[model samples]
Target: MEFWKNCWNCGHDTPQERVALEFFPRIVEMFSKKEDGKVNQRVWAVFYDSYSFTKCKKCSAPSLFVDEYWTQTTSPEEAKCIAEEVKINGVSKSGNLVHSHIYPGFLKEPFPQWTHDLEETYMVLFWEVYQAAALGLNSLAMMGIRAIIDKFALDKIGDIGGFAKKLNTLLNAKIINADQHALLEVVVDAGNASAHRGYKPDNNHVKICLQIIEQLIGIEKFGDVINEIRQATPKRT
Candidate 1:
């Protein structure tokens, strides 16, 4: 008269009343009509099964039940209209037709821990952006100095001290003008401070790095370049 099942993980014999069912769809259909262009959509069902038993063999925890059941379809014209609405409004008036069934108190059981983990992940991502910005500026300064030395007959400087001295020599000799030389000095100092020492940078440092990179490259192009480097860095969270 009644069917019985066992828990897949725990192997406890489950009662018919304890068994749970859940259903999801592989594809959702969207449609629009030939006559008026109204839209509608429906979920195309995909079957999945889950169940709970009366008790577990190892822990003897009482089996909990969870499942979902539903079936529906939409015509082509109606589906198109629904798609357009989503594009314009960002959310469907009726929630997505696909339904979920879960054990009682599933959110209360699992979500708090999930939320904390997600928050930690986000914070890590935020801190990584700042770190990337610092590293990118240092790289930019090294490249800029190498380029200048190659193009102009500027002497190769061995270390930070030597590089600063050579750069100052070029400035004093009027090979490079005041503003450009001053900018180069600022970039060298900023990069060295960030790379060698542990300087807690402020907003001013970020702004200056952005400006110096733009001056070395074109403003429009460098903005995208800086952004790409920043984005490529792994986020902390």
Candidate 2:
């Protein structure tokens, strides 16, 4: 069967075609003898456990493969088929896999009102960063991070020369503190290096950028929430 799965190498949610490498099934039979010396036969549940390797068919720059398997069961003839079923789950990658599917910082909820009000363009770029990182495209992911920063600056300060100036303006206006400003400078530089210098950063680099971006977003959109939480939290004696 053909299905879609996220490629760990290419960082793309590509189509995969499964070729059944091995399949093993277990079946049980029960028999009983009647008082009249006649035999009755019945079949219980038929269990199936299968393993297969699928190669992503959607990418051209060498295919990424995943090993997947399923464990399921079908009731006997009378009970009907497909008593329980679960599709293949990705277990391991084919190569030097350093990335995992879990990115806790990935934004799933709607943007906080202030962020949306600031610039809705950032919302789309934020998602693109998540998507690019998910598919293992760190370069593209960094670019998305850069785009988000640019969008935010443009919305807040309008056209002010380049990204560096816009960031300076935000800093001067105290929209972001010194620490936040420094961290964003790293993100902007990393993204710029990727775009202009053809630098493909590692996963850890991209991860730090994603986290900083999340923090910036939280601060920009939900500053009130942060303030309320701080006030509600009790200090140690």
Q: What TM-score does prediction 2 earn? A: 0.50
Alpha-carbon lDDT, every model? 0.43, 0.64
* Poorly placed runs, candidate 2 (over 4 Å): 1-19, 22-120, 223-237
Q: List the residue pairs that clash in candidate 2.
A: 11-135, 11-136
Q: After superposition, how far is residue 71 of candidate 1 from its true place, in Å?
A: 41
Native-referenced Cα lDDT, model 2? 0.64
Number of the top TM-score candidate: 2
Candidate 1 differs from the real structure by a C-alpha RMSD in angstroms, to one decimal, of 21.4
lDDT of 2 by residue, 1-85 (tens): 6666655444767776765434345554557877776886664544343344556686532333422222233534211222122
Query: In candidate 2, where is summed lDDT lowest over 10 consecutive residues?
Result: 77-86
Candidate 1 Cα errors over 4 Å, as ranges: 1-131, 134-161, 217-237
Give the C-alpha miss distance for residue 120 in model 2, angstroms: 4.2
